[model samples]
Target: MDSRVANDDVSYSSEAAISRWKFAVSRQYQHLLDKSTPHVLHRWIGCFAVACIYVLRVYTVQGFYIVSYGLGIYILNLLIGFLSPQVDPEIHDGPGLPTRGSDEFRPFVRRLPEFKFWYSITKAFCIAFVMTFFSAFDVPVFWPVLLFYWVVLFTLTMRRQISHMIKYRYVPFSFGKQRYNGKRASAESTSLPVD
Candidate 1:
């Protein structure tokens, strides 16, 4: 797959060029995430702080054209997961629904992995929040109305999502790392003693 998923705004013509960039960027990006992943509580707390700051700024300044657009995009991304089946229909999911006996051997793969989904949303909000400070982004509109609409949209979207999850029996979140036992029986290990 193209590293277009990583940075969608940028595009490369050649697969080789994209792969080279992916390899280089993933190492650095993975290192950053590895350092931060351990601090789960801190991460959530930081996210909350960023959100509160955004709300407070928007409330005080009454500027939310960019913020509203960002929220729309964010909600659309969330809706994508709710609408999509946990197991991708496109890929012939080799084994049937992964269960205890068959699941261990099967790789816990997903079409839209959780980390990428989250990173995109977080990046969007952060960029939008930064945009709030710039006067150019502030169009003269009643921000409270926009905020109200967002809240209503969020509620309706989540309500349907909960029902869909219950009906489908699928979880959108990825738990801890999927265990992959790579040990293989070599020819030497299986060969009989030569006498």
Candidate 2:
């Protein structure tokens, strides 16, 4: 009879442990689901809603002004990139150079870079400021809507720029003759193995 009682207690404890484990696993799964589902859905829904709102608002004159302002800012940034000095201070002086035969690629950062980013951003704000004076953006839309649209547009445009940089092996910065020669020397050393 004592052995029978012990067996029942063992079975009951095992069942209780299994139940607790299952509850914990289920809670963990629910937490993951809650976190991930909203993040992915928010990106898609936010994008779609912004597109719909843009289309709906585009018939107004304010939409045109906003678009023109954004375009102007983008153009200014490109011009700055073109005119800025080619030497990258980060590449030239940041750290010790790699050994003569290393296979690593070091990228250059801009030195004395054109203040284009600041100028373009300031220009956009200036345009937006002027637009506010004309009462054009007050077209019965929430300010948050316009802000979200601009943020999305900026993110998408920046992504495209980054993709372009990745696709093209060229860096826009200028390297002096010495840097160029160093790079050539490195290339030659790597192409021919040490005897």
Candidate 3:
């Protein structure tokens, strides 16, 4: 009887340990997914919506206001980014991954951060609101025309951005570096061998 009781206790403890390990792993995966995939998707969606609204109406008073607000918020965000330290001291001390020396030398990408997505959405809505007031939707502007124009602009901008990113292997998010640096980089890399 004593042996049986000891064996049962050991089994129970082992089961509890396995359950705890599974829970920890699940939580970790969730954190990684939240940080990477969903964050990027949200940003792209917000930007796309805003672009759509902009192309639909060129001269919206509300669009102007929303754009102003977004610009203000974006400027404030950039200021905060400039003021904040590049590295998080607390993260360094915590059990997070060690920073690579290469990471320090990399340029900051101007990609919109997660927090700014809401502001972008608000900006889109404001632009849409202005269009509604102006009856821009009633205008003979085809939806495809707006979508195609936006796509072309977006593609051109993204291509330039990607080209710059590939050449420098860095994204410049600072005020001075925010604009697409690809044309300059491409002009410079003309001498390099293409794969």
Output the TM-score of candidate 3. Answer: 0.32
Candidate 3 local distance difference test against the native = 0.54
List residue ranges in candidate 1 displaced over 4 A: 1-30, 79-85, 88-112, 171-195
TM-score against native, each model: 0.54, 0.29, 0.32
TM-score, candidate 1, is 0.54
Which digits, one per residue and each the tens of the lDDT, describe model 3 over residues 31-66? 865675556666567566766666465453323333
Residue range 45-160, candidate 1, lDDT tens digits: 77677768777877787667656666775757665764556565336556534445535444434555555555565666688788887888887876567767777877887787
Cα-based lDDT at residue 25, candidate 3? 100
**Which wins on TM-score, candidate 1 or candidate 3?**
1
Q: In candidate 3, where is summed lDDT lowest over 10 consecutive residues? A: 60-69
Superposition error at 65 for model 3 (Å): 19
User: Could you tell me the lDDT of residue 56 within candidate 1?
Assistant: 84
* Sort by lDDT, top down from the best: 1, 2, 3
* CA displacement after TM-score superposition, residue 11 of candidate 1 (Å): 25
